[model samples]
Target: MSSSESQDETHLTPSALGTKAHWDSLYALELTNHSSNPSDIGTVWFSDSDCESRIYQYLTSDDLSLSPTTTFLDVGTGNGHLLFSLLEDGDFEGDGMVGVDYSEGSVELAKNIAEQTPNAEGVKFIRLDIIKSSTELDFFGSRIAEEGGFDVILDKGTFDAISLSDEMLDDGSGRRIYEVYPEKVAKWLKPEGGIMLITSCNWTEDELVKKMTSSNSGLEKMGRVKYPEFTFGGKKGSTVCTVAFRRKA
Candidate 1:
């Protein structure tokens, strides 16, 4: 559940990585572009859709066999690109696409983007702070349980953002967000083969699998998606990777 904790400025994004304000600021900039050309909603983290597209391929692959009605949830969904990508892919006629983020601006931006995309009518963009544990979360959790839980949950750098939070580095009590995320997310997913897919640049595939499985009691290592390779000083690895874990009964 520990990592080298990247201390390099190269990994630091211009906007603060792990805070509500950081995402708010990022969408504020992209909101301008979205207004000018509704189709130009900016992509953060990866410059291209390669990582996201690969994730869709993996889900639809023979292993997962994700269907149109699979009940998808995108945690910390920024601008809802991943959900939209899933919807737009050929042969994916899914419903109940949900995207939640802590930032109001981020949710608003996602809503705006969804409005422009024809197939995104069923998508739900909710402003919820998944990092917080409170009565409010309890209320939300009840509603999630009412819906019978999601079949698949996607985390595109959301856990990485949580890991980089100042609270995670602070005293032990402040570690609640990082510690509770996997548990809370697991609860929101339908058990007995429900999947949690995470795409991260901050953590390697091994680190991510360890973190999720260790923190969440019932998660089992399913598999991971391979991205383009990067070589630094002869050692070869990818700058980013997407990993999937399944919830067991």
Candidate 2:
């Protein structure tokens, strides 16, 4: 592909939401809000689309058969709500759930919420940048390290936020960080039967699948979560989409 076509294929205009500073500030404010009112856990991204409920259903459905013992990792786990919901509502064990984010404020906010949430004592919140240090899965602790990798990995809005960034990798590839995200994170999924589900509003279903299943990503599309469709200019699409992928053996 030509340079212009390559740029068009990979680029998304940078936005404030794409920066660490933005999340740090927002989570700090959210932390304050939680201190004042424990019920205020913070924003639930894509809640209008019922994203969390659909994801829970997909995981618990007969097709996946993910049990309570199944290990989970939530990328960019803001407020740790998704894991908490899975634990509380879906009866997934808290001990097998872990949430990671780069922002300290996000980690702190999640930890605080976990303390207040029932049966959440086992859920862990860690501060780590996946794109920069995704290779360091050992830091995720003994169970995950010994088990090889998590059974289910989730990315809700994290990839979309990453795609909005203009930051380039330091490897001299001249590619944005988001371009390398799939490969970076895919390694954390078990080579056998592990699944990663991602929800995005910025990209269509086809675009999300292409990014995850790119030549270097070592992942393949397994399934998708259906959403209400709308027709605009004779084209049918949804405001948001969720797709599942499994690491290629």
My TM-score estimates for the predictions, one after another, are: 0.83, 0.95
Q: After superposition, how far is residue 133 of candidate 1 from its true place, in Å?
A: 4.2
Q: Give me the overall lDDT of model 1.
A: 0.74
Which candidate wins on lDDT?
2
Which tens-of-lDDT digit does each residue in 1-249 have in candidate 2?
632244436567899989999999999999999999999989999999999988988988999988778999999999899898888775588998999999999999999989988899999899889888846568888888998999999999999999988898887767788887888888888889999999999988888888788647799999999888999999999999999999988
Worst 10 residues of 2 by lDDT: 2-11
Q: Write the residue-wise lDDT of candidate 1 on 33-128 in tens digits.
A: 888888788765564638887887888888677677777789888888888888876546435677888888789889998887868887788888
Candidate topping TM-score: 2
Cα lDDT, all candidates: 0.74, 0.88
Candidate 2: residue 78 Cα off by (Å):
0.9
